[model samples]
Target: MDNRAIGRCLLFLGDVTEPGFAKTAFGLRDWARERCVGELRLPQATVSAGLPQLTCEQAAAQGASALVIGVAAPGGGIPDAWVPALAAALDAGLDIVSGMHVRLDALPALREAAARSGRRLVDVRTPPADIPIATGLPRSGRRILTVGTDCALGKKYTALALSRGLAARGADVSFRATGQTGIMIAGSGMPIDAVVSDFVAGAAEILSPAAAPGHVDVIEGQGSLFHPAFAGVSLGLLHGSQPDMFVVCHDPRRDHLLGYPASPLPSIETVIAQTIALGRVTNPAIHCVGVALNTGGMDAAVAEAEIAAYAARLPYPVADPMRGGPAFERLLDACQETS
Candidate 1:
């Protein structure tokens, strides 16, 4: 489904300016702005308590026909404070789109509110009904997986950029999203992390097939191999996608894992090596094709210097897709050579 068909306008409820939990909201805002999918209406003012609060009428006045619960809170559950605002938005006749594990439809009040307002409740993390267990069978055509040095290191962004860049160069490319935000953008994809552990790989396998044959499937990578809590999902995605080539995504400034401040981030070389080794468990010839650097907090000079350093260290092409240089072309060229 086209992303534009999802909603006319969206009001992101959470503050994306916050430090850690802003990745999803920021990605959605960037994607929406780039595609002209309708305006993203942020709150003009905050409550005295500093939380974002807006009535449904105010949201409509701001041209928001839908309310997106964009904050990825701790434990993936909705905050108690957000309940009232969400209910108000629902009563105001705005559809609710949420990526949180807590489904709005599951809540008695929100369900009744939607019913009363005739609004739709969209749960982005809802798993598909027909996902089968992964057979680990060999799939045809070329596939590329984006592996990351840490969680939220721009893996999905790199995958999307690669898909668009490759398609622009006349390549038949398809992006397979493994997370909620990517699912929201692509309109169709399995939320791999939400699935039961037993079916995680199976979910990836089931989502691998392209609309037509011979397309390069650019499967989005999830949690890092180093993330203590989510490493299993990452491995499942790697094996399930059975990619022929892989791109390593990293943020040079991130010295430690996102939430685990004590766990230091591994080197780029270590990340690439681990990804290749783990990927080979399902596909023996899996290789790192390129490196995607996330320079989100870095200056122009620092980002460029970091990219140059990565290029010097790694044999593969290194680029920051967000900065938009020759990285896409170089990545596509590398993929073509590998294919």
Candidate 2:
């Protein structure tokens, strides 16, 4: 059967400590459920996609083609314990789809298993070999980049939702994926985080190339400008994309940077100022259109109140993309006003 016809596979949920890293599972569930057969979790997974549990052999028996690693590990390296389970999946007649920086075939056991079972190891994080340095040249088209106060807030979701909203208004818009999960859903994108440091800006420029003057490219963001470890990727993308406008994604519940207790998250105002200062290097007219709050799993009334408070004081529209209402509509309106 063709790969597309292979349908769902057993999504392998490993021991990913950070809840955000497990976002790949939820992304596939929401955007590409047709490609998911079931889920397979290791012993101590804290997060889940809320799918039926199934082993590799059982998933293959159900006509599942591949076992996709559903975690976007921070360092992009595979865990030592995961090798055995991946090898087992290969032996059970399931291909391995990994978006990690580490290639599956690099592991000796997985290599032998794939060779014996004739299964494939797909690596999606490979960057293009011909990527060149960013030119900083002028480009046409409107662009909205979803920035964040911290990593894994609501950048990708905001971009996707905003793109849909723009399309509903009959505007020419496209959601540009910049991470592994977004790429998986969109079918193609450069994994900005995996690209070489020297070429990340170039890769980002290629990811969302120049388009018609009226067209809009809603580029999904990665990492955070305040994040100590991953901020480099974010800056590269910001400068390369040359966004005309941006939306700052935030979660009010968390006061500090996730996983980095010492580094407190920056305020949305600071982020807006910093982005304008830095992004002007590429696009002098870059500005903030709105704010997208991550109010997922919050009480309806509480979420509304929280958004209302932000809207009352903030100069820009503040809304939760997942809970679109008046505030979100205002955000959409603000985006449309950007020239």
Best-performing candidate as measured by TM-score = 2
Over 4 Å off in model 2, which ranges? Answer: 1-7, 15-21, 43-46, 61-63, 72-75
Report per-prediction Cα RMSD to one decimal. 3.6, 2.7
> Runs in model 1 with CA error above 4 Å?
1-5, 15-17, 34-65, 210-213
What clash count goes with each model? 0, 2
Name the candidate that leads on lDDT: 2
Model 2, position 273: C-alpha lDDT score:
97
lDDT for 235 (candidate 2): 99
Q: What is the lDDT of residue 140 in candidate 1?
A: 78
Tens digit per residue, CA lDDT, model 1, 225-291? 8899999999999989999999999888889998799999988889888888888888998988999
TM match of model 1 to true structure: 0.88
Q: What is residue 252's positional error in candidate 2, in angstroms?
A: 0.8
Error of 1 at 87 (Å): 1.8
